[model samples]
Target: MGSRVMPQGAQDISDPFIERHLVIDTSKVNRNAERGGFTNREQNGVTDQVSSPRRSEIVNRSLSAVKSFGNDDIDLEGGDVEKDRDKTIRGSRIVKVRNQAVLSGLAYCISSCSMILINKFVLSSYNFNAGISLMLYQNLVSVIIVSILSLSGVISTEPLTWRLIRVWLPVNFIFVGMLITSMFSLKYINVAMVTVLKNVTNVITALGEMYLFKKHHENRVWAALFLMIVSAISGGITDLSFHAVGYSWQIINCFLTASYSLTLRRVMDTAKQVTKSGNLNEFSMVLLNNTLSLPLGVLLIFVFNEVDYLSTTPLLRMPMFWLVITASGFLGLAISFTSMWFLHETGATTYSLVGSLNKIPLSVAGILLFNVPTSLQNFASILFGLLAGVFFAKAKMREKSQS
Candidate 1:
């Protein structure tokens, strides 16, 4: 056959193109090479060789899975990133709350301890020994201060009414008794022993909680109470200058302290219900308690013959005496305010436990201030008591977390 050459090449039969012949190029070229040497199942212009429905579906599924796997990687990484961000925000909030609580607790502990130490000074160092009179003045300070604050709108308080007063009057009685007995004990007991004996109050409170609130105690709580009792007995035995009367006063103080706590919890609710201002906060309770205690304290003052002492006392003539006394009053009110703030920010268990923790430093400070005689044995007992307090706090925290 005669044929003309193409522009760039001579015609070959194996070529897919032969321009002069104008042949149709309907053939697959380098089929295996195009598929990277893989099998060409759709050969010979037919795709039925591997066209079983199940096989086709399997291949489609594999391709789809590969495509989706990449998308899933992206989605998973994004989701984890978002989750981590949310966790970071939550962690920050938790840390902030914890810091606030710790700071409040610190304020409460320092203020409370200072009030006690100053009170011990007023009673023991100053030879006041007039528990009722001291309480009366402190309560008067509280009333005056709280009134000023409430009127000035610095702190909101419910208005005092006869109903609310009646509801809180009983708890106020316990509060007064607690204060009086505490002063009596402080007059005779060293600060270290005072703190050791106060562990008994925790026992009484735990029992009261179980009975009043129908709460159950774990074995850990019982063990802590046992340690507290042992600490008290050991402290008493080692106390070189122990006074039976002082110990008796402290024992009474424990009962009244526990009673005041349990009763106050109930009374706070009852008083809140009768409040006219629809706001029965800690300030209102402080006002009601101290304002109502004034009359009772006055009566006790006369009964205890402090009226005669004040009339004859040269301390009344001393400006320093009045200044210290007034300072004690301020600290007392500070105790009340910080105590409420701590309890508001944290829980009751935390408030009570931190209170126990506070007594440790107070005991040391008191011993140093008064030069109260303390042997190593007595110090050991005091340390024992402090350790018990720490364990009790931890147990309480665990219980709270579980609940």
Candidate 2:
């Protein structure tokens, strides 16, 4: 060995060194067999033995991590599914609301048309205070109808009290004014002209809002208002045929109607407050207003010498009269419900826009059904009326934005 210790070829190992290496490898193999019963291979040689319990714990931890990851993925997928379902429900609700608004607008237009047709065809056939008497009878009939509905639990009852009465008094006056002025105007003017002239209320409402309510408007709204006014005036003038008394009554109608609309907005707001306070119900307010008007309507009939025309037998005998009265009452109730529904669904501006469109059909119907004449001047009046409505709408929109 001393002779060959000759560098051991730098590759050959001595007996003692090789024996020691073998012993170490043997010990490692035995330890692996005793513990895990296996050994891991390595590039250099062999890896040290790992414990069975420790290896099992390591494997278990990895499996737990995988399972947790799978659970997290499942939770995320479930959340995504719920979110999608909620979005689908919300979209459906929006569609339902839009449909309701359209239906309400159509109902309002139909009711208005029915009223006009009845006034033109049926009431015109009767004599003095015929319109007034018809109105009075209709109110009485309405009271009965409403009372029946209330008793039947179809309509909810409201309390009667001074505070509630006072709040609605002004609104009731405005309502009466609306009915009276429109009827009076119809008596003097043709339906087409009346429809066209009604547009003027838009301008009055705008002016009232600015002067009385001190509302500010946007430039676009002002521009639209101007355009609407121009359109109405042009339309009216183009279709004009002068009937001084008719025109006068129409103007009065416009004023009264504008007042009614403006006053109603305030009254409705106040009524809501009173309702919340448990002082009144809307149905009760309606009943009280009509009941109080019973006396006023009767007095007016006598004052206007319309009592002579008011024959209980003749009125009852006339099927057409009853039809008109029935139609009018139904229309009135429908208008109330539809207008409220429209406002709830689409807001005031949309309501006004639909109202403006109503004139077109009404005017056409007036001309075709009632033979109401149209001229350049009348057209201009229509244009002006339309313009006024547009302007009023703009003013309202601007005020809302500012607020």
lDDT of 2 by residue, 1-403 (tens): 0000001011111111010000011111111111222223221322545469888678656655665565442233234654565567667776776687778778867765666766666545454245666667656766666678889998776755566677877766665655665666667666666655555555576678788889755676566556655664565456545567667766776676567656655675566566545533445555665665677778878977787655554766878667766766666555545655555566545655565556667766777776666765665566466445445555655556566
lDDT of 1: 0.68
- Most accurate candidate by TM-score: 1
List where candidate 1 sits over 4 angstroms from the true fold: 1-106, 277-279, 340-353
Runs in model 2 deviating more than 4 A are 1-95, 125-129, 166-171, 218-241, 260-281, 312-316, 380-384
TM-scores of all candidate predictions against the true structure: 0.73, 0.67
After aligning candidate 1 to the native by TM-score, how far in Å is the CA of 259 from where it should be?
Answer: 1.5
lDDT per residue for candidate 1 within 18-126, as digits (tens), equals 1111111112111221112222222123345556889877866665565456444223323565456556766777787778788888886676566777777888878
lDDT (Cα, 0-100) at 295 in candidate 1: 92
Model 2, global lDDT:
0.55
The C-alpha RMSD of each candidate to the native structure, in angstroms, is 29.7, 31.1
Q: 368, model 2: CA deviation in Å?
A: 1.9
The positional error of residue 71 in candidate 2, measured at the CA in angstroms, is 15
